[model samples]
Target: MRSRAGLVAVCGAMLAAAVALPLGGTAYAADTAGATDAARTAAADTPSALVLTLSPGESAQTVGVERAVTLTCTPSPGGSHPAPQEACAELSAADGDLAALPAQPQSFCAMIYAPVVVTVQGAWQGERVDYARSFPNECVMRAQGGPLYAF
Candidate 1:
């Protein structure tokens, strides 16, 4: 009877250890996964390229169609030279008239036109201005202009 009781006690301890070990490993894995997810979220929020904000003062006067606006690209997180960042602005009826009127002198704002591209030369750090030109056809204009702004 005594030997049987001792055997039962030993078996119970072995089972408990086996279960506890696996649970501890699972907890460690969960912690690692959580850390990885947080890191990814942080990276996504940071801007990888330089961005330009369009203001009413920057737009140029035009007639018949809208004008193409380009941002002066600066150094992204890692860049060396200044590059032209092209974006598009949609001109409303009011905007069109503003563009046409020589006396009134209409102004348009700037906005992001496309996803930023990275280059080997990268971007420069400083305040630079790029002019936005008017184009007749958007598709053709974008293709030919490479990067362009619309207003």
Candidate 2:
């Protein structure tokens, strides 16, 4: 009878350990939620100065500016897929102009399952300027696929 009781207790302990082990580990919920909130706040704070809408057939845009500006791109969902290629136009500020032109344009390519981000920086009027944007071609393609719809 004592041996049987001991066996039962051992089994119960094993069962308890199995059930409690996984639950005791730290949960990622809090961390994930905080990260998500931060990302949203940053996105809201940094509004894109220029929006370039590219058709499925269209792949690029040339932005004309007098002063140099920093540009950043982050695709929705994530940057596992390719993004469209982008080219920056040369800066042409008037003489004695305080603004600076971007030295290079941000570029990326669109992919089927992967998304990507591009960032560029420069000076304007001797003051530091920054821009941020994102593109998610893969998500768009998954939602809508076609020559005109392909991301």
Candidate 3:
């Protein structure tokens, strides 16, 4: 009877510990609610960071052509990018549509087959934007260049 009572107490203690200690640590309704509220407030108050990258495609073409730039277009457009205001204006005009950006005027381009890839990640105009596109050559990419790809 003594052993049975001890086993029952141990099991009760284990159960209590399990209930009190969740996977993420202590589980308290008020504390969890406060944490969630703080996270929400932080996200609401923080502006999204834009990540842009330019790289040479896997064609063994360009020897060394890689560039990366980050921009925050919300509240204002600013970051490591060279022309923030113009880039922001272009993006805003396109409504965050990468493909909608106007193509540069027609120009003579060599028939090279080197591919270039452009990637943009982040939010724009209160909407999430993740864009990646490949062009057949630097010339073609430049042909499609707006302030977004001027780098």
The top-ranked prediction according to TM-score is 3
Error of 1 at 6 (Å): 44
The TM-score obtained by model 1 is 0.21
Q: How does candidate 3 fare on TM-score?
A: 0.60
Per-candidate count of clashing residue pairs (backbone under 3 Å): 12, 26, 0
Backbone clashes in model 1: 12
Candidate 1's residue-wise lDDT over 53-124, tens digit each?
Answer: 222222333122222222332222222212333221111112222222222123332444432221111122
User: Quick one: best lDDT, which candidate?
Assistant: 3
Tens digits of per-residue lDDT for model 3 on 49-109? 6787778884323434388888876666689989888887777677567889888776668
In model 2, where do residues sit more than 4 Å from their true spots? 1-26, 51-151
lDDT of 1: 0.35
Lowest lDDT block of 10, candidate 1: 118-127
- Predicted candidate 1, C-alpha RMSD: 18.1
After superposition, which runs of candidate 3 have C-alpha atoms over 4 Å from their true positions? Answer: 1-48, 58-65
Output the better candidate (1/2) by TM-score: 1
Please report, in order, the local distance difference test score of every candidate based on alpha carbons: 0.35, 0.36, 0.75
- Arranged by TM-score with the best first, the candidates are 3, 1, 2
The sequence of per-residue lDDT tens digits that candidate 2 reaches over residues 1-151 is: 9999999999999999889867855665666788988876665444322222233222223343312222222221111113321321122122112123222233333555433222233433233434333336535432322111122
Ranking by lDDT: 3, 2, 1
